[model samples]
Structure formats: structure tokens, C-alpha cells
Target: MDRRSRPKRHEESRENSRRNPTTRTIRREAIRLEDVWVAYAGSGKPAIREINLFFPLGKLVLITGPNGAGKTTLLETCLGLLKPYRGKAFLLGVDTKSRKILEARRKCSYVPQDFMKPPYESYTARQAIELGLVLENTPDKNTRVEWAAKLLGIEDLLDRPLGTLSGGQQQRVYLARALARKPLVMLLDEPFSSLDRETRKTVAEILRNYVDRENTTVIIVSHDTAPIIELADTTIWMNEGKVVKVEAK
Candidate 1:
């Protein structure tokens, strides 16, 4: 083509580019479980059965149910800490039973239901929080710790030994640890169990803010949902190891 024709072609290309801009597709599921069933050793029944669940990115999910309803089992199964006896569990698109599950877990932060430390344990609250940051090689770890502590109203306890603190206090410390990591996925099992009403509200606000600002995918298991119910994008109700209801707000 001549130079004049080349100029016209370039103009057409620019118009086409404007009309068809390149776009990236984001994966919807941060965690997925397909027909999962988890059973304890020598147990006659599965702890969780016929479970199929998906947690999308950038949303807060609340899992609520009575005790012995298999809420904890579901969370553990999603993290690959408990293998599904009958089905598949995936985290960040990687199968939970695969070797790459470790890599997938690096993008996750978890606070278990029992966060209390033994009296003989020696790590300070600040040090405990540091553990989460270590997996990600996060820079400015100290600053992140401070920020999380302050957010959780635990700044004064940073230097206190974790084992020396009360159960409620320990819960806050562990929550701060999880938040400091800034993980893409966060799983908290009965995180507010030991917290008082006021602290529960405060922590719930912190979690809601994190989800909004960071687009973090959060799955929280709690028997009490008042604190977080308004903030959850989805609420899952479980009974007898099955998800009986899923309500989207």
C-alpha cells in the first residue's frame, strides 16, 4: 500500500482498538467444594456430607449453624487440613488434595475456633502476628502488625505474651495476625466466640471494611450472626452436616 493508504489503515486500526479494548476475565470462585464428605477415623458417619459450596472473590460470607453442625469441618476441608472422603475441594482453583495446595494456601489466612495459647507458650502478641506475615514475605511487617493491632483494639497488648492473655484477648491477637497478612482469602471459625458484644461489633466492622477496601474473600463461621449479618453478601445455614439454606443479601 502507498503511504497515504497506510495512514488510512492506521486510523482504522485505532478505531477498531477503541471499539474492542482488551479485557481480562477474573475467576469467580476463590474456594469451591463439590459433593464433599468428610469423616473422622473409625467414625460411622461423615462429619460433613453432600457439600457443594463456592465462595467467590471479594465478598464476605457468613456461615451460621448450631454446634455439631459441621461448620468447622467445612472450613477445614476447604483449607485442605481435612481431606474429603467422597468429593473434591479446591482453593484458588487448585485441588485441596494436590501438592499445589500449599501454594494456594499461601494466599489464605485462617483463624481457627480455638485460638487460645497454652500458658507455657512463649510468643508475644506481636510475634504471633508476625507468623502470618512470614509466609508471604511481606515487607514492612512491623507496620502491618501495628495497623492490625490498632484496628482490633489490641495495640496495648502487642508486647504481652499470648499465653498470658485471656481467651478473648487471644482471639483478638490471632485476628490481628490474620489481618496483617492481607491475604486474598480469609477463613475464620467462630472468631467471636470469646469476644464480648462490643468487641464483636468492632471486629465485625473491621472485617467488613477489609472486604470492601481490599476485595478480600472472607468466610466466617459463627453461631451469632448479629454483628456481621448486615455486612455479609451471603449467609449459609447448616444443619446435620448439610447446608439447609443459602440466603443472599
Candidate 2:
């Protein structure tokens, strides 16, 4: 409170900001839904109704509920894949209903629940991961792909045909593909469904590290939240097409 120390305090504050710029900038929500309602084609009722949610950047969010809880619908709506029939949805501040939503979606990575390949399918795991690097002529594409594969403990499987691998191996390859992209936001559905308990914990930690180092947002939809509940910054519980509870750590 000393007037004589005011200039010193200002100098210290500026130094702190210089050390960590994120502290000086206001954190913003990466996804927001306001009174949203979404339904599939030919469906008279909305799968997710009267939903309102917001998630900030650089956070890991978990969405969990029972089988018919509409978790997947809400996740898709966040990415603008499912248009809300009754209200507004936004991704990174862009209106979901706008044509520009396509551009917004390019900044996100999505992994759906069903990623199994047919037994005869032949795409190598490496090739699948490379596809995620949509940007052509990227000098570091190989490095990124390799790093992601190794990080997921699938480097040896990279050369194997995706369909020849086991279900858990295929899942790791898909996750590697997503991680290699390093998108601003990640929308993952049941990401750990195929992994064993040990693998699930490892993958969750890897994702947490990614969120911390890259300062990106990850939203996961899962029926089993045990693996990620401890790492989540926020958890949303849904039931009967509605968000019943939200817990923030």
C-alpha cells in the first residue's frame, strides 16, 4: 500500500506477465451451447434437448452418462456436425449454424466411438496417421506422426495393416492420428472403450500432458468416467437428454 513502492510493484507485475503471457490474457470458452436441441433425420424428438454448456480453452472436459443420455449428440453438436433445431450452438465463438462452421471445424480433431476396420482392410497405421496431417508439404509431418505413434506405444504397429491389428491396437492408432494433428480442440467419443485398465490410465495421462503443453481443449464423451474423472477440469453428467449435473475442479 505504500505509494513509494507503486512503480516497483508495476514493474514486477509486468515481469510476471512477460514470464507467463497466459496470465495476462483472459481465458475464453472454446465451446458454448445455449438452449440447444438436436435431432437426427426423420426423428420427431430431439436427442439432446434444452442443453446449455460452456467449456474453456486448455481444459479437459468429460461428458458421461447412461447409454441413452444423448452424450454423443451433444459432442457432435459442439463440433457443428449436428445442427441444433431449436437454439444456438457455438464452437470457438463461431455460430454453429453458419456456413463458416466448416472452417471452424477444421481446427478440431474428432474420434468417434466406432473406429473398427474390417478384417480385409489394408491401410497401414502410419498411413492412417499421415492422413490426419491434412496440410500438404509439412516438413515435420513424419516427425509428428512418429512421435504420436510412439507416444501411444504403437510405433511397432505403425507398419502393420490397420485391420490386421487387434481392436485395442486399432484404437491406439486412431488416437495417434488425432494427437498428431495437434488441433486446437479435440472431440473424442469413448476414446478408452477398447483399452484395458492400464492402457486407459496411460492414455488419459498422455492426453492430460497434451492439454497442458499445447494449451488446447479436449472434450471426451464416455460411459465410463473412472479413467478420466481425476484428470478432468470439468465433468458434465447427462440424463434423459438433459445435463443433470456439472462438477468443476
Candidate 3:
């Protein structure tokens, strides 16, 4: 390199140094499961058994398991969607299956594996987010709606009909609707099932920042390991409905 270019390179190096943080700090515990077990109403075998886990607050967690291995069952139990056959699920420091289930869900958001809405009804991306806030009876619904749309980069499609949007656009809108509540935790089921590789990476990157900035906990269920491993702080691998916890380096 020439002497004249050295100064410019030095300045660029300084800019990068100023932008990087060498250390990461953690502040709280987000999800804690203790000796939990879940079984279907009519099934003889348990879906998830003797599970124990502690997740750092604001951390992104990836959950991977085979079909029928209880990945869905675990998310449902944590969000108080299912009644546990035995043991406990402590989410946000409260028993998830107790009377507080409704309240617990208020601060939690979920996106199912598939997106299905009633036929013949028209909903714009913005309207769908608005409806979610209304369903939760959240105050400042408009602000929440605006923020959710913008955060997911769907503000440009606010007036576009949900059915008219592209697959990636539709997924982002679904994400915005879940984010409308400004929940403390987000549970996603098979988020990458239908997305292409680029969309998968983009969505994963956005989720990583969201978890960090909001101190929000995210637990995502996916069989695709690449995106999950790239974004997760820790991974919980399940087989036959049992979790194998490990810190990924």
C-alpha cells in the first residue's frame, strides 16, 4: 500500500475498533424448566420427560428434534398451552400452567409452523398486527402496531393484503403480529420450514438483534441446524422427547 492510503486505512481501523465490544454481558434468567414431564390426554407415553433447563435472559435458544419427538409439546407447555402430566414449567418466574396462564401469554408470543387464516376474509399486514394487540387488550395499540411493523421491516407493506404478499413477506407479517405484544419471550415453531436459504438467514439475523436489544428470550423449534446453530447461544437437542442441553462454542 502507498503511504497516502495508510492514513485512510488507519482511520477505518479506528472506526471498527470503536464499534466492537469484546465482552458480552448477561443480566437475567428467562426460562427455567424443572423436572417437567408432559403427556397427551390419550397417550400412554410421555411427550417430554424429566426436562431441566435454564436459559439466559435475552438469549436466543434453538430447539431441534425429530417429528413426534415433543418439540411442539415443549413449547406448548412453556407457554401454558398444554397441561403438564407431572412437574413444573417456570416461565418468567411463574408456574406456566397455573391461573396466570392468560397473563403469562400476554407477555409471550408464538408463531405456529403453518400460517392458516379463514378464507374470503381480507386482512392487510398492518391490520393483522393491530388485531393481535386488540386481542391482547394492550394499551397504546397503535404505537405497538407501528413499532411491530417497522421492526420487522414490513412498514412498506402496511396496506398490502396478506394474501397478496410473497412468502417471505407473509412470514415477516406473521412475525410482526407476534411482536405486536412486545412480549418478553417469543416461541417459534418451524420458522424456516418454507423459507429459502436467504430468507432463513435474514430472519435469523433479525431475531438475534431483537433478543439482544429487548432482553427478550427466544426459543425456536427447527430441524434445520444451519440457521439455528448460527443464531443460537445454546442448543437443546431432543430425541424421543428428551432434551440434551449444551453450550455451543
Model 3 agreement with the true structure over 1-249: per-residue lDDT tens digits: 599999998888667656632111112655778889989878888999998888767889998977887888888888788767788886666677666556557667888877755444389888877777865655688888788788777899999778777767777888888877777889998877767887788788888988888889989988878776977988888989898656665
Model 3, runs deviating above 4 Å: 1-27, 135-140
Over 4 Å off, model 1: 1-26
- Put down candidate 2 lDDT per residue, 1-249, tens digits, no spaces: 799899998999889868844334323768989999998899788899999888888999999999999999999899988899898998877888877677667678889899999999899999999988876457999999999999999999999998899999999999999999888889999999999999999999999999999989999999999889999999999998999999999
Question: Model 3 reaches what TM-score against the true structure?
Answer: 0.81
At residue 109, candidate 2 shows an lDDT of 89
How far off is residue 4 in model 2, in Å? 29
Residue by residue across 86-165, what tens digits does model 1's lDDT show? 99998877788888788778778999987778997899999999888776665689999999999998999999888899
Candidates in descending lDDT order: 2, 1, 3
For all predicted structures, in order, the TM-scores are 0.87, 0.87, 0.81
Better-scoring candidate (TM-score), 1 or 3: 1
